[model samples]
Target: MSKYGLGSPLKVVKKPGETLTLSCRGSGSSFGCCSMHWIRQQAGKPLVWMGCVNSDSSGNDYSESFKSRTEIIRDNSKSMVYLKLSGLTAEDSAVYYCARNSL
Candidate 1:
C-alpha cells in the first residue's frame, strides 16, 4: 500500500449544484510520485478516471465531464489533497478514490 486513505469513510450525499469535498492524505513515496489521481466508481460499474494534479507544477487535468467543475487543492507540506467537486447530479453518486504512485 501507499499508506493512503480517505479522511472520511462515510457515504456522501448532495443535491444538484451542490459542492462536495473529499480529503486524501499520505506520506512520502519512494516511486518518485509527481501527481495525484482521482477516480470515481459507480455502483456495479468500472472506475472512471476523473483527473490528476502534478505535484511538481501544481498543474491539473480533468475528464470531460469534470473539465470545469472539479478542482484539486493540495498542501504538499502536509501530504494532503482535497478533491472539490461542484455542480453535482445524480450521476455523481459514486465512490471516489484518491491515489498516488505507490513508490
Candidate 2:
C-alpha cells in the first residue's frame, strides 16, 4: 500500500449538502505518472467510480450518480496531492478511497 497512501482512517460524518475532502501521498515516482481516481463503496456494495484526475492534470466525475454533485479540485500546495469533493448527500455515506491508475 506504500505505492500510494491515504492519511489515517477515514470516518466522515456530515449533514446532507456538505462537502468532503480527501488527501493522499505517494513516494517519489510512485504516483506522479498515474491517473488518480476517487471512488466510493457503501457497506455490502460495489465500488463506484466517482471521479478521476489524469496525470496531465485534467479530470472529471464519470458517475451519473455524481454528475453535477461532484467536484474534483487538485491541490499541489504540498508534495502530496489532494482532491476536494464537495456537495455531498446522505447517499454519499460510504467508504471513500483513492487509487492510482498505473494501467
Candidate 3:
C-alpha cells in the first residue's frame, strides 16, 4: 500500500474536569510503521510540543510539564491512538493535535 495524508481527523472540546479523545486514521501499508503525536496550542500560537506516542515503537515521549498529567495509548489492531487527560482544568484548555506517522 501507498502512504498518504491522514484519512480522518478528529477534534474534542471539554470544560474543566471533562475528558476528550482525538482519533486519526492510518494508511493501510506495511512498508512504513505507524505512530501518533500529540501537540497543544494556546492563544493561537504554536505550542505543538505537548508529547508524542509512537504506536509502532511501543513507548511514549512527553514534554516535561505533561509527564505527570498526560498518557498516550495505542491500539494496533484498530490502528488507533488514544490521549487521555485527567483532572482537567482551565489551563488545560488548548487545541490538541494528533498525527500518524507512516515511517
- The clash count of every prediction, one per candidate, is 1, 0, 0
Which residue pairs does candidate 1 place in steric collision?
A: 31-103
**For residues 1-103, what per-residue lDDT tens digits would candidate 3 score against the true structure?**
1223344444556787776665544546531365567777777676666666665656889889878778888776766666787768877777666665545
Clashing pairs in 2: none
Off by over 4 Å in 3: 1-13, 30-32
Q: Give per-residue lDDT, candidate 3, residue 26.
A: 51
Assess candidate 3 and give its TM-score to the true structure.
0.71
Question: Which of the two, 1 or 3, has more TM-score?
Answer: 1
How displaced is residue 86 in candidate 1, in Å? Answer: 0.5
lDDT of 1 at 41: 87
> How much is the lDDT of residue 30 in candidate 2?
46
Q: Provide the global lDDT of candidate 1 against the true structure.
A: 0.78
The residue ranges of model 2 lying beyond 4 angstroms of the native Cα positions read 1-3, 75-79
**Which has the higher lDDT value, candidate number 1 or candidate number 2?**
1
TM-score preference between candidates 1 and 2, better one: 1
Residue 72, candidate 2: alpha-carbon lDDT = 58
Ranking by TM-score: 1, 2, 3
TM-score versus the correct structure, for each prediction: 0.84, 0.78, 0.71
Taking the tens digit of each residue's C-alpha lDDT, what string does model 2 give over 32-71?
5767677878889998887776675666545776766666
